[model samples]
Target: MAVIATPVDATLQVVVQTGTDDGGRPVTRVRSFRNLKPSAVDDDVMAVAKAFANLQAHPVDSIVKVVEIALTEEQ
Candidate 1:
């Protein structure tokens, strides 16, 4: 049998490590960007994530990781 690829939506989970919060505990912010190309590579996406994250208002925070997620269409 032939293989069929299911259509999916791609998103990047940008995790940023922010400074300690009011409680003096480490904090993290997760931002999701949807509609990315399914062919996007981790390196490429990470580059973009880093650049975008750097330009964000939260300058004190540093990008920890960029995770790609795909949601397949359901019949």
Candidate 2:
């Protein structure tokens, strides 16, 4: 009989970027969250879904929201 083994992965840094508001103000804010998963797809999907759900439930118009960013890790 043979056994299969799997390797572990490091944590990821999720950087969320947002746009400026209609008031001509810059939203200088940086938020980071940690995930202990090997794949990025799962984390991204959940984050997007949650954000959308919150916006739908609250029904508020925020001038800025998470638009795009890079996914990397911190040493």
Candidate 3:
């Protein structure tokens, strides 16, 4: 994983590449979540879950997405 640090108040964008399932098919699902906590942004649970749900609903083997999370000036 690559980590890029930015200004405290700046928005953070995370580019994630998903892995293929047993069938070796590629997934092409995308989703995003905003106003997330720093820890949630780091973990990216909601965004990941949303992506997985979309992939499952669409029958995709994998998915890649760029999720954006907002950060506050104060920690």
* Per-model TM values vs. the true structure: 0.55, 0.26, 0.27
- State the weakest 10-residue window (summed lDDT) of model 3: 7-16
RMSD of each: 4.9, 10.8, 9.2
Give candidate 1's whole-model lDDT.
Answer: 0.66
Off by over 4 Å in 3: 1-27, 41-56, 60-75
Q: Write the per-residue lDDT of candidate 3 for residues 1-75, one digit (tens) a residue.
A: 444544333223333446567788664544443444444454565466555566443443333333344444533
- Which pairs, if any, clash in model 2? none
* lDDT of model 2, residue 30: 33
Best model per lDDT: 1
Q: Report the number of backbone clashes for model 1.
A: 0
Please provide, for model 1 over 1-75, each residue's C-alpha lDDT reduced to its tens digit, 9 standing for 90 to 100.
444464455776666666678989878787777787767776888798887877766643443333345445445
Q: What do the candidate models score in CA lDDT, each in turn?
A: 0.66, 0.42, 0.45
Each model's total of backbone clashes:
0, 0, 1
> Sorted on TM-score, highest at the top, how do the candidates line up?
1, 3, 2
Query: Regarding lDDT, does 1 or 2 come out ahead?
Result: 1
